[model samples]
Target: MSVSEREKSYEWQVEDARAGQRVDKFVTAQGEWSRSLVQSWIAEKRVTVNARAVKANYRLQRGDRVALRVPPPEHLAVTPEEIPLDIVYEDADIVVVNKPRGMVVHPAPGHHTGTLVHALLAHCGNLSTINGVYRPGIVHRIDKDTSGLLVAAKNDSAHASLASQLSAHTVERSYTAIVHGDMGHERGTVDAPIGRNPNQRQEMAVVRKNGKRAVTHFVVREKFKGYTLVDCRLETGRTHQIRVHMAFIGHPLVGDPKYGPKKNRFSIQGQALHARTLGFTHPRTGEEMTFEAPLPQDMVDILNRLRRESGL
Candidate 1:
């Protein structure tokens, strides 16, 4: 089949560690695609090794390049919902939205509706198809419980530009979080590798083997008797990077159900993390732009309660 305009394309350079893995397995491990879906793509000649069509069981070489194209799902449909969006900025090329806590970024098995994508689809009507139908113009994502600012592209060129900037580590993303313990130091950096937890398949952890490089620079903003407010800037965006790193250092974020203590005192719905500031070069204008969102009311209330208890 001819490549569709809505098909998403991806390319990866096989590293030494993944030299002997089957192409289908490798591709499935990289992203949201399942092994069965990858095999279907391989069978359809949508997957290539070094620009040559490859089989599902092809063993990858260390220096080989693997490319895959995924067409929009014909069986699955993403319906546009009239959910309201907290748009911060908008132009012909892009739109910046401050996604509220408890909103999923894209459509998945259980989150088919009531997602940021659904709201964006209803609001924008026309979004870049670089990420296929489920993700539409989504360039990056923050956790569902972590309310923050994220930008969506209106066209392919803008999507490519923003994605390239993220890969180059030039886009600025800063977060504010409330962690469990008072930090010992005023400032520090967590330069560790992050990958899926071997013990818990559903969770992420700091792993030494086969893990991608992840770094987070953090500074103490305020301290309470049992908790610390911190400003964390990500040098690399890894899934659950901040939560994993903070927990690894004995300071898991407050209300973090996945990484924190089983019994928590806080009554918050989820982790007390928020994407506070986002900066990037305008894809169409080549101008630097930055946007900030104030802490959500729930977080503000928690902080106020802490301050009151400490007589601050």
Candidate 2:
């Protein structure tokens, strides 16, 4: 791999140690840029593997050459709007938020405003930039249709700590979801590799090759004749772990638009999934903490109806 003599161009020849790592991750580790920045660079076609364009999630192999052409930074601005936020916990280092359903974590191509980031910006004025400008303070994310708990880093150190915990799979996350089928097993684990859906560009699918390892452990919390309430614990945070895994196992969530049926008896806006609990070690004090968010009104109301109908 060679660097251009004039501009801010960088290249790397992948080694054994770097093999199997995401290209964006490997490049970011070589420099001080945030993952979001690297991902943006990758998305803008500024990065390439062996002269071929690759997605950010592309896994590198030994002997692969990666090159990055840096253009002068074009500041992508995100305005802070006066959106109401549900602040669950806050301190000097972190902000724990109970995100409502329909609220996005950050700005994306189609979703550029009215996000949790905007609310956080209005509430705190500053957030950790490790995830870059669009995703300040965001340590992790929940789908726009899934409501529940998320933690944001107010500073860089906290962001690093939280990110490390996630990488190590030490952070605990739990979700409550209503699925369409009655699971045969009371508890089970879905260990599969998840990659971008080949058929649908906007979806994820389980693939034997070119997919990241994902594991989800779930327990049947309650059961009805045709539905089940499951508690899911993720071993890896893929884009759509619970939703995809459940659908893969023939038990899609009640109102999932992407992975489930077109119509359901429940007239909910989106998926019947909620991030109910989150646990992690305090970045500052080294103390362990766990937080739980009560089921939202829609979930509560649906459960009530299910109980009444099923006589449970």
Candidate 3:
């Protein structure tokens, strides 16, 4: 590897004394570094061994020499622009934003600016660069067309604390969704493994061996003519976990262009899913904090129309 890839990096072998321990703990013990630093490296996806990125909880085997390459710190520029944002809540540590539909959380290829991060940089000064240059303060993200509450960390300390909460599954993330067909059960849970689709690189699939555990609990809030409004809580956050699981269970999200049918029984632009609520322990104050975003007009209108037709 190049020198730049080695400066903010290190390598160590798993001695017999440290075998069978968690990778993060093993790395910390071997390097004399703080556990928090090791955890950050894990979260940043910087630590690898034998050309594979392993999770922090991965058990280390004896004689396993892990190579870590920490990239250079991203220096983000704060350029102000007139990007409109719906600020939900703001504190010294974090910002809760009610992101509108069709807003990308961060920049990707072909989408450099006009993102929530760029807008945040324009509105707020500097943000935590924990996730890297592309996403400064983004702790979590919603889909481009999915609207609702999202939290942005303002400093590294807050980012670390929030990351820990998310890692421990302490943060509460709930979504409101409209799915086709009334579920057979009033409430149900989907415990399935999710991993990258082997055949389709762009999608996620349910796999037993190479997949990560994902759990989604969903309850039917209201039923329409042939659809259902459900509340979903994420026990584990994975890419498209909700959509994939819901689709897997034969209740694909309505208006979902990717997973659901092309034409919904109703007319809508995108999937009728909203991040209705998010709660977490405040990093600084050690107090429970929660934020809620009511359904967007499109969703509200869809539900209202459904209710009107159903007369419920």
Candidate 4:
């Protein structure tokens, strides 16, 4: 990575500010950076009011020019280690990958190395830079323990189109999961809205307000003695929506540490969720495309073992 790419700057002018407004809030509203980022810059003395360093709580007057510098996130140089990748499909516009379990989708916090992003960087140089330094070509994300099909955009135009499709709920995504209990019904829909849990910030929950609309449709595929295999489709994407909704209905996914029962029915470290299919239209060509990935051997073995144990 070049040193030049590690820093970015922009100028802003505070206008018509009411008295008693803090400098950080005034500058943040006038600039592209978020308020939290602005506060950090003020503390670091990277934000200057009329070429003078000021505290975040400094009062703002009219026509104050604020200069701010935001450093690029600390990123580990991506090395193309020869990690095996299951390339389901690839084209000029996009690439489909069968991401395996235990692989983080992109670099973050403790997982700065050995991520899919690093591998993609090595495999395809100069991927779409729309997602910034951490995620070069990523369009969507699957949790680290959740294995399944994922798409990557190779260029900016492709990224823009795919992102639009996702936002508009045009992209089709499907998953297969093993949940804790048998769903008596053949099929059902969960239309509960989801948001961050008020009590537990780390988890998501069904909330009435301060939540986004989320709908999940599920069909019972196979029923074991105490568990059910379900095919799930998403109508809206919210963080941890499927996991939270299923658990709310008393059928947490097997092996799901966060949402499942205290005693996990399966031996896997993460949730028993697999992104089985993905479909989208090519941004440039406008042709529809779809891809499917069979369940990983671990999930298959676990199901088979449960069946045999139940004498089914």
Best by TM-score: 3
Q: Considering TM-score, where higher is better, how would the candidates rank from best to worst?
A: 3, 2, 1, 4
RMSD values for the candidates in order, in angstroms, are: 5.4, 4.8, 4.7, 6.3
Q: Write the per-residue lDDT of candidate 3 for residues 1-312, one digit (tens) a residue.
A: 655444576778778988889988767555424455678888888888666888888898888889886666645653545699999999898999999988889989777768999988877787887677777888888988899999998887888788778878999999999998878999999999999988888888788978999999999999888899999999999998899999999999999987898877666677889999999999999999888898999998899899999998
Off by over 4 Å in 4: 1-79
Question: Tens-digit lDDT track for model 4 on 1-312?
Answer: 687657777787767844468888766555334455568779999989889999998987777777888777555356655567898888787888999999998989999888999888777766676666677788889899999999998887888788778867999999999888778899999999899999999899999988889999999999998889999999998888779989989999888888987786556879999999899998988888888899998889889997897897
Q: Write the per-residue lDDT of candidate 1 for residues 114-203, one digit (tens) a residue.
A: 999999989998888657668888989999989989999988789878877887899999999999887999999999999999999999
Whole-model alpha-carbon lDDT for candidate 2: 0.90
Clashes of each: 0, 0, 0, 0
C-alpha lDDT score of every prediction, in listed order:
0.90, 0.90, 0.85, 0.84
TM-score of 3: 0.84
Candidate 2 differs from the real structure by a C-alpha RMSD in angstroms, to one decimal, of 4.8
Per-model TM values vs. the true structure: 0.82, 0.83, 0.84, 0.77
Query: Model 2: per-residue lDDT, tens digit, 256-299?
Result: 99999998777688999999999999999999999999999998
